[model samples]
Target: MVFRHENIRITIIAALYFAVAIAEVMCELYAYKPLIYVFKPLMPAMLMVLYFNTSRKRSALFFIVMTLSLITNVLFIPDSQDLLFYGLVVFLAHRILLLYYIIRLLKINDYIPAIIATIPFLLVYFYLFMITNGIPENSFVVLIFQNILISFICGIAFSHYVMQDSRRNSWLLQCGILFGALHFIVFVEKFYLTGFSPTIFRPMAMGLNAFAFYTFYEFVMATEKSHRDDARSIA
Candidate 1:
């Protein structure tokens, strides 16, 4: 019965995600800003359901991060630069907490690949900053720092997967995080450098970003079950 209940929850979450993804594409193509804003936080709100089902140790942290993320997305709907900054600060806090959770849950024994992976991101940021001289100095600095934080989150995910092979779903979590980070940087650069509004692509990008959390949730559940099974075996 418990297993069936969990499956039902997962199915509902997946259906909501697919709905959000379709809505995102439609909004992007049709330039529906209002509808886009409406769907932006839908996935995070869905993940709030998963928060309750997960182990008690991490559920509160996960819920907090998702709540902050929902607020951050909503904040971006406004045109205020101050609002954008506040959103970024909230997002930064989310990442910091996520990093803390990842560290607590996964052993980090392999640092070389993670360090190597971050170099390319850093170099690319430098190259872009140097070549795009027209971008406002302030925007450039903020974008680069944002890129760094995203990169750190991706790197940590990758390292956690590589060093902890016992976790079955870590690779999925890693790929999801990496995709979200890279795509986010792409959109940010396009927005800041070329004067292109993200309306065309922000939906897909943000949808993908939200989906990563779902994958991470699955990873957490998988790991927890594995741990429990191991404990049963020992007993």
Candidate 2:
């Protein structure tokens, strides 16, 4: 019975991580993009965040994926090739930037991390929207705002889930999902507005959702810890 429970737990975690990625990929294949498709990875990439192992591993894997994703993206949609390169560079910079935010998160409150981590993305998107591309109707800002909240909430949920059993993977995944969801929201808006079809957005989202595996894992751990603490108090 115990073995069965463990296996079931594992399956549930894996499934949560996988679902977002698969959904985004399917969306891309079926939907593609009508205008600027910055939101290519719509759902799939969210799941991928859970798969990253350690710091070194995460950096290396991220670099490789960013490179490959950029390459594939350029070949598939050659128009935004230069922009994609720039985007990847910016993403690389985020690794360092994330270090700064993580420090802030741990030092301050949990919510601070999300704001510090995601605000830059919003700023960048705003610049790209208004300056690079003419700003959309201010009314559209509401849509963007909602997306930001979605990403932030998703990050919190993912982070909480990852705290369970992911070890280092949990912390890293939490950060990834937090930022990934925010980015996804931006790219999707780009797609809707411009018609530049970039698949990175969806993949990024999947990567974020992958942290769901870690989220549930963390929940279990917290529950166990609480029980143990109670038992200790009783003793």
Candidate 3:
């Protein structure tokens, strides 16, 4: 019964994911969002669907949503520059590595694997960003530092949330809340500072945040299960 319920939830979330992608593209058309050329937020959205979508039906919905988002981007922004394609391929490769590591590392606490994992994660983003964006000599080091710091902050937050909690569902929800709040703040900052950054940015940001909030809320509920498990172990 609970499994069925989670399927229903995944379906709803998958629909919401599609909506956010459309909204984000609209924002790009109007407000000229500079930082998100590579669709970074989509990574988190995929992560969300992966979390709740265990059943085939829900998984299909997730696959469709992600595919549609890609198609939407292609339809609207069909520039297809060499560098863009290059960076994109690199990013996809990096994502593959991330997904692999995320799954294999689950249930393991050893720090060695993590240290080994960081090499691909760091080099992939660093070299690709430099190549795609053409890092200026003067600001090269600074750019790398800033990017590294931001990624470190985000990754550490996820690690802390996931590792500190043995309950995977709770960890997932905490991550959702963290992501939701993070994007919300980013959207607001851009909206307030720039005013009318393509009508879509705000909604996309809010939608993503809402998505995060749901997962986080679910995680809260899951704590009860963890408590019960602990009680059983103690007994």
Q: Please report the candidate that would top TM-score against the real structure.
A: 1
Better of 1 and 2 by TM-score: 1
Of candidate 2, the 10-residue stretch with the lowest lDDT total is 50-59
- lDDT winner between candidates 2 and 3: 3
Q: What is the TM-score of each candidate against the true structure?
A: 0.78, 0.39, 0.32
lDDT of each structure? 0.64, 0.45, 0.45
All candidates: CA RMSD (Å): 3.3, 13.0, 14.0
A best-first ranking of the candidates according to their lDDT comes to 1, 3, 2
lDDT of 1 by residue, 92-194 (tens): 6776677666655555566677677666666665565566645544455566666676666566665555655655546544654655564455445455445
lDDT of 1 at 225: 70
- Whichever of 2 and 3 has more TM-score, that candidate is 2
132-187 per-residue lDDT for model 3 (tens digits)? 43333443454355345434423533554555655654456365345535433442
lDDT, candidate 1, equals 0.64
Q: How good is model 2 by TM-score?
A: 0.39
